[model samples]
Target: MEIFTTVWKDWTMYQKSSLLLMGICIFIILISCIYIITRNRRLIIHAIASILCSAIFTVGTMVILHVVFDERISYIYMLIPLVVFLVDIISLSMNLGYYTSTRNKKSFSPISVKKELLRDSLQLSIFIILLFSAISVFMGGALFTFVIAMGATALLIPWTNYLLLYWIYR
Candidate 1:
């Protein structure tokens, strides 16, 4: 689209690399989440948490960046990735809670290596997000909007999986 082309022209190589990394990270995180969500049809908390956290993270990050840094990127550009990164973190947090809950133990399948796997996955995802934020800060906030775009991507991927599949099929 014209908008994407214009935005693409405006970003630097570092900013673009950051965006690509963020996109890859979001895709991996969302894929894992979609798998879990499909497997555990009884629980919808992960999906809900991802949505709420996406909104909160987007607004919070935007306000904080505005106050702490002096970058002038479009709101749309910044919003795309912030939502993505936040949703993954949120989804992982909910997953951690669910896996550790008493309810999990009561299920027919006892707690096993799956819990460990989930915990590790969540930790890795969180670490990546922290890395993105830290690196963006060190880069003088120029790529901060791309980082936000990553978060936004994280938010959309899981929820739109069905829509994506439908589009592909149609």
Candidate 2:
């Protein structure tokens, strides 16, 4: 039909990728829910929640900025959710490593891994907020700059958390 053709032609690469990413996120969420139910792993539930929230927020914000405010959304915004998702996967692997490491030790408890992750994530989040604020101030202090800083924060915190955990655990 003519409508299908028009829609197909008008579709941008970003839209295509966004749709794909959303599909992947949905699949992950469903699988994670099943996994949580079967294994009673509450930690994974937190990762699932983070992935869902960050992906939704990133995509929704991009839509609003583009459609409502007529702002030029960058393709880099697409990377945020993907990066967050990847970090979650890596964190899980790292946690598994930590568990094995603790098992081999005489005194270290597995619970310490969760505590360390939570502490590092909180510290990284605080650092990102302060850093973003400082950087945004120097970048002209506009509303748009603030929005950009927030997006960057959403992208940075999980990534930095993963790196810090890797450094400490490895």
Candidate 3:
């Protein structure tokens, strides 16, 4: 209880505002996703992807904040909703495009989609991790910055996979 109080007192305006902003964006995205899903029952896969990605983001944020206990954690949190929404929108658009392009096809096989998603996600995650590592080492050159960059990159993997899966199958 005392520790919680101290932590709360130490919290800055940035952290509070970041949390509020994240919550608002998440609410909007959630509503939009639900609307899209309801309109097109075929997009059930999207609902699953969004839910899984959201869970991963939420858990990663909580764990990182707990481990670091730093004010700068809010900086990472602030970017979460923006990244999630951007990926969501892009993937949704791609899914729509794919659907229209293949309207004549009876159905997309889940097995092929899964294989492609896994391979693409692994490739993308590796690229992202390496890119962040290089940027942190070359630009920041600080252990702290490296750790933060790596953490952010780690948090991004699930969302990337979500994006790929949605794009691949809709």
Candidate 4:
């Protein structure tokens, strides 16, 4: 209990620069994951570009929040980009699954709309969880607690994708 309290105090003392550095590291890791998943050169280039754009947008928003609104840099700010990255991952997974199942052919089936809607809803749910996690973290929740919440939220992506694929096949 004493050790945990010490760790929490250290975490609370982390500076804005440290948070920014961590965010940059996560962005790099995300781009690397994209490259590994999609080996096509053009796709890798596009994915890196997209990730860079997202990083810029997030940093810009944080700057505005800090300067204009006087918001402090915290774990909550990190959640914004994390959620955005998760949504992108879910969307990419769904698109890849759809294309693989359809063999790159145009879908003329009536169920396509349903599949798309499900994918969209899954993305929305991810966003909502992101919002919730951010709020919880900002409220001085334990780091492990917020991590558990994120992990639980992440489970939905695979489950939603699996169910969607099963329905599409059936």
Model 2 clash count equals: 0
Flag regions of model 1 displaced more than 4 Å.
1-42, 68-70, 79-114, 121-138, 144-170
Tens digit of per-residue lDDT, candidate 4, span 102-149: 644576343673466466656666766676666666555344444444
Q: Residue 70 of model 3: what lDDT?
A: 46
- Please give the distance, in angstroms, between residue 68's alpha carbon in candidate 1 and its true position after superposition: 4.5
Task: Score residue 126 of candidate 1 by CA lDDT.
Answer: 70
Judge candidate 3 against the unseen true structure and give its global Cα lDDT, from 0 to 1: 0.55
Worst 10 residues of 3 by lDDT: 70-79
* Candidate 3 ranges with C-alpha deviation above 4 Å: 1-38, 42-45, 48-52, 55-59, 68-77, 84-100, 139-170
lDDT for predicted candidate 2 compared with the true structure: 0.56
Distance from true location, Cα of 73 in model 4, Å: 1.8
Candidate 4, lDDT over the whole model: 0.54
The digit string of per-residue lDDT tens for model 3 on 1-170 reads: 34346557988989878877876686567657656644555455565566467556645655555567543444445455555545444444544445445545666554445554455456555665676666666564234553554447454654565564657455
RMSD of each: 10.9, 8.3, 5.6, 10.8
Determine the backbone clash count of candidate 1. 17
* Candidate number with greatest TM-score: 3
